[model samples]
Target: MILCVRFLLDARGEALLPDLLGLLGELTPVVEAAPPDTALADVRGALRYFGRDAEQLAALVRVRALALHGVDCVIGAGPNPMLARMAAREAEPGVTRVVPGSADGIREFLDRKPVVALEGVGRSMARTLCTYGLDSVDRVAAAPLGTLQRILGAKAGREVYDKARGVDRGTVVRNAAARSIAAERPFSRDELDPSRHRRALLSLTEELGVRMRGSGQVCRSLALTVRYADRTGHTTLTRSRTLREPTAHSASLTEVAYAMYEALGLQRARVRAFALRAEGLGPAEQAARQLTFDPADDKARRLEAAADKARARFGERVVVPGALAA
Candidate 1:
């Protein structure tokens, strides 16, 4: 069986994930890193050596993580990765949630959830599904796969169909190297101003973009994490968007970052911290750059190159965006 553990880590606590991952490694060799605080482990082989069932083993791992690194986590175990992830999402933090290996049990567990709660279903897809009255997992499962295909594309239709049925073939892939860059800014006090939030996000994207470009890497996805006030129980909201293509440009990163921020519509949220991550990284040389005819776009690229040159020679702060210049 596979187990997915979602770690509850604060902004300062993120540094402990690597230590926690190492602690998990003591239990099984199949620990797969899920970035921004999560991991998947295949414990089938360790069951005999540990002399425990999946739930019990998950408890032991959870205790070890807490005892060793003061990291409390929620663990969900199931027959497959999708079920495991969904189980974790359903459970409360700092607990072990298990989905039975039986088909009937899986269906019961998944059937009542809102379609939006499903792992792969986004806002747009959920709205589309709801329009057809497939607003719940059971409804989605009952619909013919062809209907989903007509609404979505063939690949997405097949994927969601299998997910609705709690069938996933994915496994814990071990020894994968992280290929993303991240930056975080914690406010001295909880911030409510939307302008400040935008500035922070822009700064983070600019910082991450510079690092990616410096390393000759391009990212195909952007992730935003908003940490709320401690008074609200240290809640953190995270979202990710896949770009149209890989890019190491600040403009591309800024556009996607702003889009995600605006979607949150947090007019007066008492946000304590902001984090931005660039993901799905590849060599810059490997990414195909599309030709642009707009003079403004051409001018921006040229200025970006010059700014990089200035930063390389003078310092990172040599070419700051006007919004960031106090």
Candidate 2:
């Protein structure tokens, strides 16, 4: 059985997590708390006790969250986790979205959404698709897989193709833990210098790496998002060759982050702001390190270690990147 559930809380502060988790406990024992104001729950077992099917059970959860806890949430129901998450976002506040878990149902649900609405298709890729006259998710799904791969990279193209067909195999893992730390800054003004943007990206990546080592977590993937002056944004995904050894090494993360920024080819483009999100987080004990013979890599890492110590003793603003200085 496949059931995807989400609770959009009315509250926004730290209390949101505990309150949402409390409400999930009333419906099922298997609940995973997503940060800020979202959560996922497995309700296969709750169906019998609630005397309703999956859709009915989802409605009950939403109603109780509203009537009892005074939280208004938009709930999405699907046969799998991806569809439910997407559906939930499709609805406005205080509504329920249900995607019938059937082939016909999947087609109908995706028929009207833009290609960019699919989870992995970012603005650049979607624009490339639009050039080909494929504006909707249905058009992209109907196009050949090879066609998509040609427009995007092989891995990203395949992922988008699968999502368009409603073929997501990911499950709602209960008690899922976070493995990396990240922060993003939205610029108040648009800038065109690649060097300045790189500085901001490096700062965020270094901050994330410091937090990772302090909390004993290592990151494997680094995701970057760039918002353009026009309000459209693009996301770039890249991975480290080996698992990051948790050591609060800002330089190590900075190198990887800079490489990703260069790959975006942002020369002469007006960029609003940049975000660096570290992924593939895991316990320090579970991470494996690779032997690097590059002297530059080692030197950078050593410098990063010293910088982290200074930041800890002082303040984050003490080591601000030049471009970020007002």
Candidate 3:
């Protein structure tokens, strides 16, 4: 069975995520970075070479992360990403938790959890489930699929039903990057304009695209973090989307960032900051580009190449999008 590791670190007021991920690379090359301070490592292949079970390998990674970066992390080991993440949440910081890979073991581990603890079950969904007397994992598990589908939408219902049984179809990508590139922009005031938010996202995408292209890297996914302020306090909303094709092109990055921002639907929320991250990176040369018949797309890419060359020779200031020009 394949083993997935969820490395959860306390990353408040610090930027040690890259260092911790670098340490994981010492154990396995297959790592998917989940920021601001979480990562998933597939150690199925490494277990044979390291001569250790998933638990031992997870412990080793935690020790190395602590020794090298003075960062203590909670590691959860299981047959897949969903189980590993669930186990990690149940574990104390600076400890390792491994779920046995047997049917009985997985069921026992998942049955006692709260319905809210199931992945992708948001606060609203949990409230709805609880209203219908489906409050615990065991309760949800025992409920009929048609019942769940009636409570939640068909897609979400099926997803939660499978998760309650500890089944996840996700696999760790072999070329998943060990480090992700991130950029954040803070507003001067608690702004409440959608146009301003879109502009901020555009700026971040441009910056990330340029940096990625310059480093000869392409990202498989993009994450957006929106920090906002309300009457009670400040909070941050984050979301991520995987791309169909890996790219470092500004147009592609901007499109996805804009879509994510729109999905948040923050029409009247006070904004504090905007952060965008590129994850699951790999060398640009290794990424396969889909052939396109659009001449406009080809022309835009050619122009981008020329602009990158100019920026390399002069500086980032040499090439600036009109929207960003001062």
Q: Please report the candidate that would top lDDT against the real structure.
A: 1
After superposing candidate 1, which stretches have Cα over 4 Å from the reference? 131-133, 143-153, 190-203, 214-216, 225-245, 251-271, 280-283, 292-326
Q: What's the CA RMSD of model 3 in angstroms?
A: 6.3
Clashing residue pairs in candidate 2 (N, C-alpha, C atoms within 3 angstroms): none
| Residues 11-67 of candidate 1: C-alpha lDDT, one tens digit per residue | 565577788888778889998887768888888888888888998888887888778
In each prediction, how many residue pairs overlap at the backbone (N, C-alpha, C within less than 3 A)? Answer: 0, 0, 0
List the candidates ranked by TM-score, beginning with the highest. 1, 3, 2
Quantify all predictions' global Cα lDDT against the true fold: 0.87, 0.71, 0.83
Spell out the clash pairs found in candidate 3: none
Higher-TM-score candidate among 1 and 3? 1
Q: Residue pairs in steric clash, candidate 1?
A: none
Which 10-residue window in model 1 sums to the lowest lDDT? 8-17
Q: Write the per-residue lDDT of candidate 3 for residues 1-326, one digit (tens) a residue.
A: 33334444442322666677777788788877765677788888888898998878877877886677666777778888888888877677666778889989998898878899988999999999999999999999999999999889899999989888888988777555545788888899998988888888889998899999999999999999988997789989999999989999999999999888888988688999988999888999999999999999999999999999999999998988888885
Off-target runs (Cα >4 Å) in candidate 3 are 1-19, 149-156, 177-181, 185-205, 209-274, 278-309, 312-315, 321-326
What is the lDDT, from 0 to 100, of the residue 256 in candidate 2?
Answer: 71
**Residue 11's C-alpha lDDT in candidate 3?**
27
